[model samples]
Target chain A: MKCRGLVSLLLLCAALGWVLVYSLWSIAFNPVGGSLPEQVSKAMADSGVDHPITAVLLNFRSYDTLLEIGVLVIAAIAGISMARLPSLEDPAFRTHDALLDALQRWFVPLMWLVAGYLVWAGAHQPGGAFQAGAVLAATGVLMRLGGMPMGFLQPGYLLRAGLILGFAVFLLVALVTAVVGDAFLAYPAGTAKYLILLIELFLTLSIAMVLLSLFVAAPVNDAPESQEGHQ
Target chain B: MTPDLFYAFTGLVLFITGLFGIIALQHLLRKLLAFNLMGSGTFLMLVGLAQHRNGTDPVVQALVLTGIVVAIAATALALVLIRRYYHLAGRVSLERDATDEGRP
Candidate 1:
């Protein structure tokens, strides 16, 4: 026991030492100069964009956002396909627990409201599509854990449409911009803020649906042997 | 000392802990939870990196956001695989090690 305790203490000390070294190195070697927050704030001020998060998510790296949406859609599709437990008749799946089911009943709707608020608030604050989608997905997970019927949770045609809506809107915006003699996805100078917000809103909806579907696709082991034997 | 650095460090620690959990745990659900912890950690790091001066490079934020989406997608796929594996094999882990060999 004494030996084991000594070994554990040594391990803990090593870990603390590593973290300290890494932090010190990072602080000393970071090439970026000036206060990051101040510089970022100043840059936003210069661009006349009011919200920093919006400016970061939409304006500075819009393409990355686009691809990120693609990743979400792809993951959702992949997960649903992988689970392969088609229809609710499969006996291998088990339902959620009673307490969880009751909690989910009350929590799902509230989460949706919170998600909507987060998406809307992204215009001038820290909330945005990603955060909103995460929140929305959390709600879906709650319902999923509650075993609240597959029909309500699974990704149907409407869910698929929602998943792509943001991409569609973004594509249209880009196409229109190109037609008007600007680079693709380039908002008219000064109109970027609102346009970006529009894009983010659609993206948020898409992301939320995609994430929820992914959660819903999680497989369960309650399928009966009759169904299993067929497979 | 800064908030970003502190958060980043916390995220890194979480990520490593998640990695360890994923490797150490045998339950599929537990593994999935660990994977999620790691993904969230990476996301935290990415967001922290993006919070740099010069207006928090939209590019990095966008990339990180995309990564988060992709991670969830991959996680969904993994969960599905885990469920299917459990159904077919009657277990989530590959090994019959003493820790989880008796688990149902």
Candidate 2:
């Protein structure tokens, strides 16, 4: 039986290799390589940002980011609905691992600092709200694994605010810009930088919260038994 | 092969591997991970194509970044749906009941 499985896997790999070769040949025949157009580059510059990606994410296509934030919120809400799920007799994580606790005492704060730095550096370099939010969520997950499942399930007000603040702020700003006679999300000429940062700050907070909630709400607590639950 | 071709082919291989895993795996967690693998494969292709030249295209990079964020959201919602299914049905595999094969 083991040999049979290996044979099938080898067969699958061989078939997939042919597919890869076909794909590579096609790309070699028709290459799709080009730099950004001059208009886009000039537009990115005019957006009052040093980083092109930050400019695209926060200025050029801000609406998409807003909807992306909405998607995250909806996902978090769905995940949180399963928070009342039935876990195993033993808790999901070790209630107290001294080593984990000792490390978290210092590491978590440092992690937050790095996350903040990522958000700040986004103004010019590769780091940004999403990177910072992901790092922040990593700390949240670490804290939970360190016996504090409540790290993400903090007070009701904080939870609601963290989840809604980003979406609400983005919407409000879009509306304000439209009312001011600019397009939706078109920052008043000179104020694009501050507005983008403001939007990113809220987005980072909400994204961190959403990811943390998603991790806490996953139903893999009874994972070991589930592995053998089938015939 | 040049680096661009190499990386693009690697991405395609990753996508195919994830597709195989999604089709063959019975475990829901494994399936979820395979989906993530597929997402990453797509991202690798985008970035690799953009890297065809010396400097990467900011527009493509931005789009890929957006894709990553949306992918996470989709995965989270998919997880919730899977968890709920398990809660109600008491199993993780998407297979039909043994007796229900060939039903309309």
Find the candidate with the highest DockQ and give its number: 2
Worst lDDT window (10 residues) for model 1 chain A?
A85-94
Give DockQ for candidates 1 onward, in order: 0.36, 0.37
* Chain A TM-scores, candidates in order: 0.71, 0.77
lDDT score of residue A229 within candidate 1: 50
Predicted candidate 2 versus true structure: per-residue lDDT over B2-92, tens digit per residue: 6875676778778878877886666787889988998898888767765664446777788889899889878877887787677667767
Query: Whole-model lDDT for model 2 versus the true structure?
Result: 0.79
What is the per-candidate TM-score for chain B?
0.84, 0.83
If scored against the real structure, what TM-score would every candidate get?
Answer: 0.70, 0.81
Cα lDDT of model 1 by residue, B9-102, tens digit:
6677777767766765677788899889988887776666545323355545556656766776787778777777767676668776676766
What is the CA-based DockQ of model 2? 0.37
Please tell me the interface RMSD, in Å, for model 2. 4.2
TM-score of 1: 0.70
